[model samples]
Structures are given as C-alpha cells and as structure tokens.
Target: MESSPLSALEQRLISHLQVLYPQTDAGELARQCLSALKLDAKTPSPQPHRNIWDQRDIMLITYGDTLRWDDHPPLETLHGFVKTRLSDAISVVHLLPFFPYSSDDGFSVMDYTTVNPSVGRWRHVSALAQDFKVMGDLVINHCSSRSRWFENYKAGVEPGASYFYEADPNADLSNVVRPRTSPLLREIQTQNGIKHVWCTFSHDQIDLNFENPAVLLEFLSIIYQYLEQGIRWFRLDAVAFLWKTPGTSCINLPNTHEIIRLLRLLIEHKAEDAVIITETNIPNRENLTYFGNANEAHLIYNFSLPPLLINTLVTGSCDHLKNWLMRMPPAQQGTTYLDFVASHDGVGLRPTEGLLTEWELDNLINTMKRFGGKVSSRTLPSGDIKPYEINISLWNALSGSVAKGPDQWQFARFMCAAGIQLALEGVPALYIHSLFGTENDHDRVEHTGQLRSINRHIWNMDDLEHALNTPTHHQKVFEAMVRLLKIRRGQPAFHPNATQYVLHMGDRLFAFWRQSLDRRQSLFAIFNISDEPQSFNLAELNLIATDEWTDLVSGQKHEDLLGKVTLMPYQFLWLANKVGKLSEPN
Candidate 1:
C-alpha cells in the first residue's frame, strides 16, 4: 500500500517543528503533536483566517476569586455579577489563572489540567463560557516548584526526568535578562546528583526545558484540555522567556517564537476562532516582535500604554504620549493590540525604556511614591537595581499630579484614562479592581508580603453590592465606566483595527481620530490631561464641512466646524459624525 499524502495542518506542523527542532525528526514530532490533539486525520480543517473580534469586544480581567459570597464558589459569584451588571458593557471575561498554584498568584501553576477547587471547578468556567467569551492563561514559561512534573524530575521519572532547564551554578549567567531580582538558578537535589535549575521569577517557580520534545507534547495536551473546557482565548504568560541560551540574554529568542508559532498552528487547526495572546512585557520595539508576521500571537499587550498614559496624566503633558503613539505601527490584518491602563499587576516601567526621559521617569516615580505607590526593582547585569514596575491601585496612582501634587480630580483623571483607552486601536480590558475604583490594599500587602497584592484586592459580594448601591467614589467610578463602555460599544469607529491617527492638540490636550473600517463613522476623541481647563477650536479636527457631528459623551451638536470646544479639568469628549448601532444604556 502507498503512503498517504499530508494534510495542510500536518504540513504546517512539520514546518514549525523543523524550525523549532532542526536536529530532531520533525515528521515524527508532528505525528506525536497530532496524536496529542486526539483528532482524526480525516477531520476537515476550517480556515482560521476569519476575523474573530470586533469593536464591541471588551474584556474583563479578574481573578476567579476576586468576588466572593458566603456559601458560593467565587467563579459562580463572578458569573452572576457578569450576567447581571456587566453583560451589556463587556463581551469577554479573562479569568487570570484559575488553576491551582504554589505562588505568584496563579502564574506559578501546579497543575495545568484542573481548576483550583478554592476558586471553582471546570463547570463554573464552562458556565461562564455559555454566556460570554472566556480567556485563560497558558502559563507556558514555567511551572510551580511544587508541581508534579518537578516532583517527578526529583524522583527520576519517565516524563519529567529531563523536563527542567539546568545550568551550571558557576557559569557566566550574568548576561541573562529577567524581570525579577531572585537568583537565576536554584540548587536542587535530584535522583542523579546535585543540579542547578533555572528559576526566572522566583525560586518557587522552576523553568521548563522546551528543548525536550516531550515537554512540548505535554503542553499540547494541556492546550487540548483547555479548549475542551471552553477557553477559546489563550494568554501565553511570560512567553518571551520560554527558550534559554548559555551566552545570550535568553529572551525573545528565535526558538521561542517558533514554539509560539507551533502552538498557534495547533490551536488554529483545533478551533478556528481560538485566539493566542502573548504577555511579553519588554520595551516597545522588542514587544512588537511577538507578532511574528501575524503568525505567532493573535494579540500582543500594548505594554507601553500603561506607563506612558500614566505619565501623561500625572505630568500634565501629552507630548511623550503623542510621540509614542505616532511611532507605533498599526497591527497587521490577523493581529491587534490588547490595551489597558491597569491590570492585576502593577504599572510596568520597563515598557517605557525609550519613550520617557530619565528626568521624566524620576519625576513620575517620585510622584507615584508620594501617592502611596511601592516601587519594585529588578537586578541588572552590573549588580545595580532598577525600578521595574510601580505597584499601586490605578485610582490611588491618579490621586495626584507630578506638578500640582494631590488634587480633587482623581475621578476625572481616571475617566480620562479610560476614555483614551476606549478610543485606541485595540480591544480595551478593564481590571476588576479598576472597574470598582479600588484603592491600594495596604492591609493585603502587609498580609501577603507581596507588592502586587496592593492592587489585587478581594471584595465580598454583599459589601460590593452595597457599595455600588450607595453613594461613594467606587459607585461613581463604576457608573461612569459603565456609561462610557456602553457608548463605546455602540461606535463602529472604536473597532480594534479601525484607523487611528494621533492629533496634535498641544501638550495639555491629548487627542486622536478613529475612523470606522467602512469609512462611514469618524470620531475625534480629545482629553484634557492637565488639572486646568483646556480649550481648542473644532477646526483643529478638520471636520468634514458637510457632515454634522455630535459629542457622544455630552450630546452637544456641532454644525459649525470652526466652533470652539472646551474640556474641564481631566475631562474627555467623544465627538462623532454618526451614532453606531448599539443603543445607549438607560
């Protein structure tokens, strides 16, 4: 009998494997990968090039246990909240690592196949998927030191005997780039002898050796299990550090990109609409490489946005923000950006490597420190410490400005940030704490002894519901965000891939124009970044003389293109030519 011809999926798998493991048998590895999928060879593969997202696709980033009730699991409570309060504003729920973990709040995953019982079971995740799109973390870079794989490695077992990246303790690993100050290698006693294994984030998190094909096959199985559990969006956490080399920086390596490509290929083949998002928190230019000609990551975190936007709001100037935005290239056809001002973690400074000056950075850092922010530092090759991220709640971080000190414009400043993010050329994600206008949890930070815990405040369901029902800053911020998000959902010009051009509205005013894909809707989003009121003539927008425009936020008509427009301290306006399809919230 003659051998069968290879399918398109198999051919793509072989190509990726050949690049990832040139010395190994690419064909056999491809067969094992296909076997991990447990799919029949005759199954017809769907074309995966279809657009999987659009303008109304807003995402909520939260821990599964962020909201809790007395007798119910946290995931069920989260599902209830999303169904009742957030169903109209957001379309996706990004559960930040519901898996059991040893440390780092779920990034150090102990088990890849099951949900943590403390949060909820797989049924709750599936339940969330029934009503809204769900996103899950892949945690691809490393595993918990307490994980089964690591234990097996210690016992010299079959699958994990050589599963970890081992390095000589005395080797010149000073060149390795990492985001943590922890020692790069940990001394562990294995079955054979004493070995020094890589530990990228912390000693509790052991880095995996992807050079072993078995390791790759194991994660493939995990991906298949996640897809079965209704997770269509995969966030590859710390993916840039997946591959390591002896003499290099050991980040953003070619083999790492190839592994991502392989994962992308396998995922697309299994589920056509599935998405892959890479969490590469590097400098602006280096972060862009994860796109890999639109074949690697379907979405990349707009890492530079958080630091740059915060600095703009605090320093009362948009020059740096505007310059950075102008330099940013629009994402390709099959890819887009994931934009957010705040998340479960802190506002990273590493992403602002070339965008901000030394003086500006020092000023911003000092301002944040004055506003109850804690600075987290990373180790350098030269044995110096540098600020890596600013750990604080978004609401608190905007409590004051660098020039004016503490002010009463905290609410308005945050709204300005949200409005600008909504109009940017990407899908906007709101952290659960950000939506609630949470302040820094100094108590939690004291309890957990983790800087990130400052922003990861947990809320009791009843107290949270009471707070929203009452008159408070949290209620005010939540209501304003909901109104803005509802309005954003209605606009076609706010599409993730819509045309965006930075407007030169002076340093005090930050402005941008977004046009719908069909060119029917044009929106001019402008914000006053300073604490003082700012005014600009509508003519600066160059509005079409024939088209009537209205301020989507204030509902003000603008027939005269030359009419002047004014924004209050830290206020924002969404002036649009046409209202989109979705109705405004009551």
Candidate 2:
C-alpha cells in the first residue's frame, strides 16, 4: 500500500490544530479532518472551489423556511421556486441556516450535521445545487443549550464537559463588546455542579470553548461534512465572537481570525474554490480586519452600506456615503464584499459608528421610528444601552408606508436603493423580502413578539410567485430588478474585480465609474437619491463630449454627451460609450 500523502495542506492543518488543540493529537486530528472530505474519485472535477465573484454573482438571501409547503418540505419548495423563477435573474441563493435550532430563528443551532426536518433533507440542497450555487450559513459563534453537546456536558461527558466556557458570575467582563443587552453569563446545573457559563448572545445559546481543541476539531468535522454535501459558500455567521479571551473586547480577537484562517486553509486544500464569507456586524475598521492579507475571509459583510445608503437617500446628501466610499480600501485580488442593503435581520446601526456623526445617526434612528421601525440596543462597557439595529423591511424603512404617498414615490425610492446597491463595487445580495417588495410584517411581529419578525415574512411559495407576477408593487420591483440584474450580468464592466473610481456629481447625485480588467469595457453608474431634481454635465463624470453614450436603463442615446441630463427623484442611470459592444447577448 502507498504511504499516506504528506502535503502542505496537512502540514498547515496540523500546525493550526497543534496551536489550538495542543493537548490533543494535532497530526491525527488533521488527518481525520482531511479524510472527511468526500470528493468524487470517479471524475476529475475542474473547479472544486469557485471563490472569486463576478458581476453575475447576485444572490437572494432567504431563510430555508421563508417559503413554506404543507405537502412537502420547504427546501423542496424553495428549490423548485429557484429553478422556475430565479435560475436566470439571480445566480446564487443564500439559504440562511436550515439546521435545527432552539432559538434566534436559526442562529442557535441544535445540529450542524443534519438539515432541519422541517426543511428538506440534504437531497433538497443537492437538488438546488444542480441549478444554482447555494450559500449556507455556518453559525460558528454559539450553539443551542438544548443540543446534545450541551446536554452531554450537563451529564459529565468527556469532550462535551470541557466544550463550553464557565466563568464566575462576579467576574468583570465590562470590556466585552456585546451585540445584545442580554446578560453574558448563565447559571447552569452541570454534572460537576451549578456553574455560570459564558453565554454571549442569550442564556439558551451557550458559547463554545474554542480554547478546547476538541471543539475546534468537532467544528472542522462539521464543516468538512458540509463540504461533502456540495456547499461551496459558507457564511460564517456572527464570526467576530468566535474566540473569547477574558478582560478584553472579545470581538474580532486574533484567535477568532486565526480560526477563520484555518477554515479558509481547509477550503484551499479540500475544496479549492470554496468561499468563506465572514459576517462581522461591528464598525467598519475592525470589520475590515477579516480580510487578513487575503488569507482570512474571501468576503466580509459590507455592514456600513445599508445604513449609509439609507442615510444618503433620506438626507439627499452623498457627503457621508461618498466619504465612506472614497476612503474604503480597494478590493483585493482574492477578496470582495457581499454588499447588501438589508438582510434577514435588519439595518444595523452600529456599523455607522465612525462614518456618521451622533446627530446624523440619530437622524436615522428618528427617521426609522417615524417610518414605524423598531430599534434594538446593545449594552456598552459603561452599562448604558444604545440603539444597535433598526428592525423593519427595507421597503418600509426606505419609502415609509405606501399608504402615505404616491405609488411612484414608493417605487422610485425602492429602486433607487437597489440601484445604489448594485452600483457598489461588490457582489449584490438582496433579501427575499426586498425582492418580493414586501413591507413590514406588523402582524407577524405582534404574533411572534420578535422584532426581527418584522422583516422575516413567511410565504407560501405558490402564492408569492403569483402575487409578485401581477401588477402589484411586489411584481413591479421584482420585474424591474430582474431586468436590472439581467443587464448587469451581461456587462463586463460590472465585474466585481473591475477598478472603480468615485466620481463627483455634485451633492444630490451619487456617481461612480467602473473599468473592466482588460480596459475594454467602461461603465459609469449614477443614482439620484434625493426627492428634488438634480442635473450634471455628463462630461463632469468623465464622459467625453465627443463620445456617444447609451443609457442602459432607458435605452436612450446621448450623442451630445456634454449636454446636461436632469434626473427625477430617485432616478438611476448607467452610461456607457460602447453599449453596443459592451452589452453582451444574454
């Protein structure tokens, strides 16, 4: 028999494991983890991991149970809908944690290995994978207390007994950055005795002890199992809190980044193209650290974009957004952002920390309240609570209630948000609620008594399809968005790797220019975020006076490019000199 191959991947895995789990057999555990990858040996796969994104990389973010079916599992229904409705328009489906959970929707995971019985089985995921790439959330920060591991710990089980952190109730943990106002420690009656375990998010979600090598190995096994099931895109949910060291902020700790880097390394060897997208909802500077010289995360959530975008549209000023964009680090060769306006949660306000002033941020909170949005707060080290996230659907949050204004007002503003999101220099991910043009789910919020329920609407797949196809508001945005994405994907200039130049288009207008990697295709995208009219000389944005331009959105020709073009409230334009050539046949 041939000797087991000793490759650099195995060496690196052993090194990481040795550091994290020195007491355990690092070499043996690394070998075990690598052995768990179930690649098909019958055929030579070309691309095991396709991490780099492109203009075609638009995604729909939805819970696996977002769409329901009484007769079959919801994942089956979701898979069918993606095939029928979204196969062409969107290329990826980010199915938020379909795993069994005890609380926090799907964030408090009960089992990492199996799909929730309520959602379909692994077969359903594989079915969808055949059509479009599916991005699965790996909630690595914490697990449900009701999980077997937690139960085992309560029963004095070997590895489980040492899997979680237990701290003294009186310990001073004031320096920790908390996402919620909940108490950090929870008293649990374990087999050893009654103890206070460090439960970061909630009492039910017990924080795992990454200091224990067994925990890291267990997660590695779980991740390898996911890779086996063809999940190339793994979204590390709440990754900033992955590793905890006492007497510190415990957010974005170096050990946490190291853990992420190990996972990325696993992907590099086992699944070459697998993407690790980190979700850090903290302020911008600390969040950007996940890039880690291109070895940590292939993508980090652009958390600042949602609030900043809303701020731009609400204030009719691009100063904040423009300043933020201009100062943003250019996308590295291997990494980019998963840019989004809203998600299953809400518009996070914490990300606006350094970007907006106290007054500007307060303006947003007040505006959200005026729009019937709810705010959730986080605890500070000073023991004061501050607003952290605004809970409401992106539609209601943006244009307020449709009942309050003309349909044009609502539609224009909604499309403008989408336009700016797409115009950003990253892959755009739209929440399902946004795509369906749904408003706040006040009924669900009252029924479930969960603030996030305001945005998390459950729908019957067939009903949503029929409802969104008609001339309803949902259908209007859906149709327009589809057209926009279809056009966006066909243009080479919109590639995520393209170089972007923030252009000066006065105060009310947001403009940017994108040039393709080969310099063959160039497109300038501009958005009018204000209610009032705004005009600018096309030449000001660098469209030469002699160059013939085409407005992709309107299909209008601009031969006299230097002339002024006035934008109506919330109008967006995509101008390209060689539209005929750049507009590829889809």
Candidate 3:
C-alpha cells in the first residue's frame, strides 16, 4: 500500500506547524489540527456571505453589561436595547469579552467555552446574533491565573503541565516589549517545585505557551464552539504579544505572525464567512504587517486613528493627521480597517510613536490632562516609565482645544470628530458610550481605582431611555450619530474598501475625496478642524460642471462648481455629486 497524498489545507497546516513548533512532528500535529477544526464528512459546506462587508456594515462596540435594568442579565438587556433603538443604525455588535474572568474586566478570561453566568447564558448571545452580526473577543494572549488550566499546571497534570511560558527570573529580558509596568515574571510554587511564569499584561493574566501544540488545539476547539453559537467575527485580543522568545523584543515575533496565519486558515476553512480581526496596538508600520498579504486579519483596529484624530481636534491642526493618512496603504480586497475615535480602553500612545513628534505628543498629553484625562504608564527596557495611554471619555476629551481653554463648542467639536470618522475609507465602529455623549465617570474610577474605568460607564437602561427621549445633549448626540450612520449606509463611496485620496486644504481644514468602486459616486468630506469660521472655494474641488452636486448632510444644492462654501467652527460637510438615501438594514 502507498501513503496517501496530503490535502491542500493539511500541507498549509504542516508548513505553519514547522514554523511555530519545529521540534515537534509537523505531520502528526497537522492531523491533530484538522481534527480540532471538526471538519468531518458530515460538516456543513461553507456558505460565505455575498459580500464580506460593505458601507452599511457599522459595528457598535460595547460590553455585555454596559446597560443594566432590574435583575435582567446584561446580555438580555443589551439585546432589547439594540432591537428597540440601534438595529437600524448598527449592523454588527462587538461584545467585548463576556467570559468568566478573574480580573481586567473580562480580558483575563477564565473560561473560553462558556458565557459568564453574571452576564447571561450563551442563549442570550445567540439571541442578539439573530438580528445583528455578533463579534466576540478571543483573548488569545493570556488567561486568568484562577483558570482551571492554570490550576492543572500547578498540579502537574498531563494536559497543562507545561502549558504556560516560563522563564528564569534573572534572564536577560531587558529587550522584552510589553505594555505594562508590572513585573514580567511571576514567581509561583508548582508541584514541580518553584517556577516563574510570564505575565505580559498583569500578574493575574498568565501567558499561555504556544510552543506547546496542545494549547493550539485547545483554542481551535474553542473557536468551533463560538462558530456554533452564531459568532462569525473573532477579535484576537492583544495578539501582538502572543509569541514569546528569549533574547528578543518578544513582541510581533515571527511565530506570532505564523500562528495568526494558521488560525486564519482553520477559521476560513470552518466558516467561509468568518472574519478575524487582530488587535495589534503597535506603531503604524508594525501594525500594517498584520494584513499578511490579505491572508491574515480580515480587519485591523485602526490603532493610530484615535490619538491622531483627537490631537487634530484639540490642537486645531491637520498636518500630522494628513501626513499619516497619506501614507496609509489602502486595504486590499479581502481586508479593510476598523476605524473609530474611541474604544473600551484608553487612547493608546504606542501607535502614534513615529507618526507624532515628541513635542507634539507632550502637547497632546497636556491637553488631555487639562480635560481631566488620566495617563497610564509603561516600563521601558531601561526601567524608565513613560505614558502609554490616555484614559478619558471621548466627550470630555473633545471639550476644548489646546490653543484655548474649555469653550462652548464641545458638542460641535465632538460631532466633528465623529463625522470625520464616518467619512473615512473603512468600517466605522462607535463605542456605546460615545453614542450618548457620556462624560468621564469619576465615580466609577474612584470606586474601581482603575484609570480605564473613567470611560466604561455602566448605564441604567431606564435612565438611558429617558435621556434619549428628552432634549439633553445626550439625546442630541445620540440622534445625530444615528443620522450620520444612516446616511453613510446608503452611500457606495463610503464602502470600507472604496477609493480615498487625501486632499490639501490648509492645516486647519482636513479634506478627503472618496469615490465609489464603480466610479459612479464622488464625495468630498471636508472638516473645519478649528474653533473659528473657515471658507474655501468649491472650484478647488473641480466638481464637474455637467452633474449637479449636493451636500448629503444639509441637502443643500451647489449650483456653481466655482462657488465658495463657508463652514462654521467645528463644522463638516459631506458633498457628493451623486446622492444616496438612508438605507434600511437587511
């Protein structure tokens, strides 16, 4: 009898295994990987979505328990809220880590296969997925020390005896790149005597050893469970630090990229429509590598967008923002960027490393402090501490400008930031708090003693509904955001992979031109990033004299291609030659 030939997927898996675990039997591990994918003869055939995504696909990022009422589980409450209020505007809902955890607000996951009892059961998650696409965090880098796997390791069990990365406390870890000020090696007493395990984010979050092929199989099974529960989008949380190596920077190591490629392969094979987004909060250049020739990371968090956009709004200059935008390579066919101005965590400063100068960064940091933002620091290789992120509410962060103190243009400024975000060439994700214009929650911060708590406001559903029904700024911002998102949904020019060109209209004004893929629609998104009035000739845009143009936001017609248009302080316009109406969700 002759040996059978390896399938294409098997060949690819073996290649990845060779790269990640060279000492192991690659062929045997490949078979084990295939088994983990549950790709049996009875497996369902892949049914990919007609379009992986389009202009109408807007993702709303929120915690499972962000909104609470009575004794109802937060997931149920969140489902009711979305169905009643946001179903028309948001096509996708990203629930940030709803798993049982020991600390770090769910990022330190204790269980990968089940829902947190406090949040609700997996049925509640499936309920939301019935109406909207659901996205979940895969917390791939580390797990809570309280997890059963860690306990098994402590007991010297077979499955998890060597499941975590260990290093000598005195090793030359000086070159290790991590985003925490805590000690990297945690000394623990195991059944096999003393051991020092690596803790990248926090002592409670123990790093898993991917060098062990068994750990990879465990996560593959977890991914299968998530797919069965109606989750097609996976956010690989803190993935940049996934692979560890001694005598190296230990961040974005080659093994990390190989693992991502392997995961992408298995995921796409399991569910053709499945999307994998890598949460790599690194510098711009390093961040771009996650794309991996369109084979890895169907989407990446536009990590540099928050700090750079906020800086532009506060400093009233678009030089840095424009420069960064121009250098960004447009995402290819199978991949795009997830753009946002704010998220669950703080505005990461690491992504802005080479993009912004030291003086510019310091000025931005000072402005954030003036706006009541807290700075979180990280330990450098030389034991020096430097600011890593700015923790503050998006509403508060845009309260005023660096040139002037707190002003009366807070609402306008916030809207301007959001408007620019929506018009960019990517899928726009709005945090739940940003929708309601929530301010910094000092009470929460004081209660939790965590800097990031300032932005994670837990709202009472009753209070949120009441505020939306009233005429408060919360109501105003919520209604405005919905309207903007609705408008974006119908425009082909706003597709995540549409054509984009940075336009030069001076430093105080940021402008971009977006054209539909089929070349039918052209939109000029211009914003006055200052606290004063600004005007420019429409002729500079070179609008076609034959076709009529209209401002999508105000519905005002522009008869003369050479006419002048004035934008008030913190104002923006979505001018287009061809108009698209607000589309209803399918």
Candidate 4:
C-alpha cells in the first residue's frame, strides 16, 4: 500500500494517536494505518448503521476445524458446509480463534496475523467472507508464551520486553480477580534477569500490558491486519482480564473500558459496519459495563441468558428466568445483547450468582451430572472454589441421556431452547454443536483430557453428512431450527432491537410479547417449560381467538372459543393478534 497524501481527518486521527502515545513515534504507525485502509483525501466511510443487526442478522458461531473431510483443511470444509447448508439461515459466521495456538483449544494464541495451516489459509477465510460476514476472534487479553513476542521479551528485546506486564514476586495481588485458579505470576529466566511476569490465565498465556503504549500500537497493527482480511466483527476473547492494575479487581476497570473505547473508535473511523463484541462471563450487571455509554462494544455476550435459560428448562419453572429478564436494564441505542443458548464452552454458572439460589444451582448441577455433564470450577474472590461452568452438549444437558444414540425427546427439548432464544429481545446466536443436536463426545474428552472437549467434537465429513441427511435427531433439530429461524427472520415482530414485554402466563409457561419498530407488527411467544400440559386465558392479556389472533409456529388460527388456551408437553406457540384491543378484527 502506498503512503498516500493524508486527508485532514487522517491528520486528526494521527494527532489523536500522538496524544495516545506521547513519547513513542506514532507518526509512522498512523501513516501505516491510513495507508493500509486506503483512506483517500476525502471523508471516511460512513459510520456503520446500527440497523444492520435486525431480524435478518442471525449469527452462527463455530470453529474453523469443526468439520473435516479427506484430511483437507477444515476451514475449506467449513466454508463449503456453511455456504451450502446454512447460507440462507445465517448471515454472520464467527470463526472462533482460527489463528495458530498452543493450547486451551486456540485460546492460547501463538500467532495473530496468520491462519492455522491445519485449518486452511487466508483464502479460506476470504471465501467465507464472500458468502457471509465473517467474525474473527481477537484473543486480546493474552498471547501464547510460545509466540515470537513472548520469546523476544525473554531475550530482552526492546519492544517485546516492554509488551508484557510484570510485578514483584512479593506484591500483594489478593484483589486481583481470578478467572482460573492458576498462578497470577510466573517466574521466568529473562535475558535481563529473573522476572516475575503477570500471567492471569496460565503460564502459557502471558497477559499483555496495555499500560504500555507500545503494546497498544502493536494491537492496533494486528487489528488493521484483520480488517485487511475482511473481518468486520471482532470478538475480544476474555476481555475482563485485560488492563490489569494492582490493588484492583483487575476486571472491568475504568482503564480497561477506556482501552476498549479507543479500539472501537479506531474501528469505526475506518469501517462503519465493523463491530466489537466483548466476552465477559461475569454477573449480568458487571458484564454490561462494557457498553460504556454504547461506545465500548457494539455487542456484549449475554452471558447470563444461557444459564438462566437452561435453568428454566431444567426445573420446568420460569421463576428464575423471568425474574432475571424483567430486571434487565434496557440496552442503549447502539448496543444490544448477543443472546445464545450454548457455545464452544459449557453453560457458565458465574452469570447466575444472584439469579439462582444455592439450592437451585445445586439441583441444576446434579441434573447435569445425571446427564453425563462435567463441572469445572473457578476461585472466588473470597478464596473459595465453586462450580464455574457446566461442560455438556446441549443435547445431553437437556435430555439427561448419556447414550451414544439420540434420546427420544432430543428434538423437542432442543427446539424449545431455540424458540426461547429466537423470541428473546436481542440478536440470537446458535452454536454449531447446538444447531445439529450433537450429543456428548466422551471419547474426545477422554482422549484430550479437556472436559470442554466433550462438546467440541470435530466431525468426519461422511458421518456428519449421513447424520444430517437421515431422519436422525441431528437432522430433525437442524431442519426444525432452520424452519423456526426462517419464520423468525420474516417477522418484523422478531426484530432484534424491537421492544419486548415479558408475559407471566403460568408456572409451566414462559412468555414474552414483541412489538416491531414500526408498531405495526406484534407477537406473543409462549413456551411450556415443563413436560406437563399448561394453559392460560387469552382474556387475561386482552387477546382473543381467530378474530384477533393467529399462531405463528403451528399456523393454527386461534378460533374464537373458550378463554382457556392450552399447550402440550414442551410445546411453544407464537401468537399474532390485535396490537392492543381484543375486539374482533372486522
């Protein structure tokens, strides 16, 4: 790229960079960014419109190597599969940590710029981008110890040595919040001397020091590279662990928020449609702080929703889930929740701290165990260890079955979760495993010894094609979910940013009402959380049959009749009726 003449806006951006890095030589860095983006001597691209994420912006989150064929690079196969099987249903595909990594299933990043050879090359990524918007994982909090940056730091390399955070071995770190119970600092033999460097995740994943302008500059470079690769959606992995400072919780600090805002600013300046979603698996209120006046993240993972939704299905009650949703603060104009039922990681428990009672949590835990799910723990600030997450496939987690084969109730239970996800007030995301009704991969877990492995199975192309083609649980769930999503995509009432009202139907029923942005379309989605039948009265909510209501899910016209409305075991109904009055339409 040529170092072209700078636009005034480009000059102003450079000045801001200079202010950000007062002593460092930021002129060249700024010029490089401007050149890389090819910003002409004119106004920058229009700032991304928030309207891009509506009913149609459904996302499919998966790994590059999740599907393999004939030893071909998995990314190629992933692109082919998504392009063929999921193109119309999904618009955005989040390729989780496709870069070269050492451990933690690609979380411990060894390289940032290049794709893992085993997965495929940049062309594969570009190929997927051609079909759907591609989201890249920016493992920003820490980098692999085996990375060149870390090795350079060990050799006392000027820029790299200054990139990592270091603290005295005797320094007090009690206030530092721990995501894992691992050691906070690791003693390393550096070229300069013995050093105790901060490593919040693991010795292999050394935390980067954002306090250093050099580190921030490097990060800016990496992000620009991703932008060059056509990735517009960037998920900051384990962001709460970023920007650590002494004597603080070291999570969601003001400095951390500021850094995120700065990055958001840079991205918006270059590409308006680019997005940043923060990954913070903490309590709901604290997790939302990433929004930072709607300037920090365009989306923050609704970490609370997964566990709360799971608890609702597990206990056959909506008390916990309803209470949580009712109390949720409204999302700001440009920010919204990324609601998901399951992910590569298991169901997180930390997000349910205040939402679920100890007894309820225990009941949920034991229920998961009965279904062959494994539990992983985290160290609390109080120095006590407790279950942090439940590691299980959505299939096994819901059906309480550990058999290698499908459960009889698999499709019903899975679709119930998906319906709830779609009916929510935000952009609903589906994990690849969850979409296929995949079951536990105990063999993978035993072989890799990573509990999360049970839910992270890479499929053989032939086996996967067979499963998806036949009338197996996987095919049934996939086809049903796609059908639901298709219906959801067309309904203005299911708009991601539309206004939602939680409807309290009854003990076994969970419901929410959605109104379109234009106020011309509306829907009342109701779910039976238990196996038992549940019924309600339309008169209770001023809704009536056939005259003013139609069931969207089953296409059943609600004929005028008795006030009682009934739902079968695990059945869900979506009703569209008169927006307000229950009088006859005519």
**Which candidate do you rate higher for TM-score, 2 or 3?**
3
As a TM-score, model 2 comes out at 0.94
Deviation from native of the Cα of residue 506 in model 1, angstroms: 0.6
Worst 10 residues of 2 by lDDT: 39-48
For model 4, how does the per-residue alpha-carbon lDDT over 1-586 read when each residue is reduced to its tens digit? 9876776666666666665556766667666555555544365644433655777778898999999999789999998888777766778899999888999899999889889999999988988887889899989899999999999999998768888999987877788887777778899999999998888877899999887866776777788888888899999988888877688888888667767876776787777888899999999989988988877898889899888887777677888888888998767667788999889998999899888989888988888888888998877667888898999998888883222223455567678889999888888889998888888999999999988998999889899999989978788888898778777777778777888898877667889888888887778888988766888877766653435677878877766544688887679988886432211100
TM-score of 4: 0.92
Where is the poorest 10-residue window by lDDT in model 4? 577-586
Give residue 378's error in model 1 in angstroms.
0.7
Error of 2 at 15 (Å): 3.3
Q: Which prediction has more favorable lDDT, 2 or 3?
A: 3
| lDDT for each residue of candidate 1 in 1-586, tens digit (9 for 90 to 100) | 9989988778878898888788999888889998998865555665544557888899999999999999899999999998899888999899999898999999899999989999999999999998889999989889999998999999999777889999988888888898989889999999888999999899999999999999999998998998888889999999999999988899999999999988887888788889999999999999999999888899999999999999999989999999999999998877899999999999999999988988889999999999999999999877789999999999999998997788899999999999998899999999988889999999999999999999999999999999999999989999999988998999999989989999888999999999998999999999999999899998878899888899899888888889887789998889999987653322
lDDT of each prediction vs. the true structure? Answer: 0.90, 0.82, 0.92, 0.81
Give residue 32's error in model 3 in angstroms: 1.3
| Alpha carbon deviation, residue 274, candidate 1 (Å) | 0.3
Query: Considering TM-score, which of the candidate structures 2 and 4 is the better prediction for this target?
Result: 2
TM-score (all chains, Cα) for each model: 0.98, 0.94, 0.98, 0.92
Which candidate leads the pack in lDDT?
A: 3
TM-score of 3: 0.98
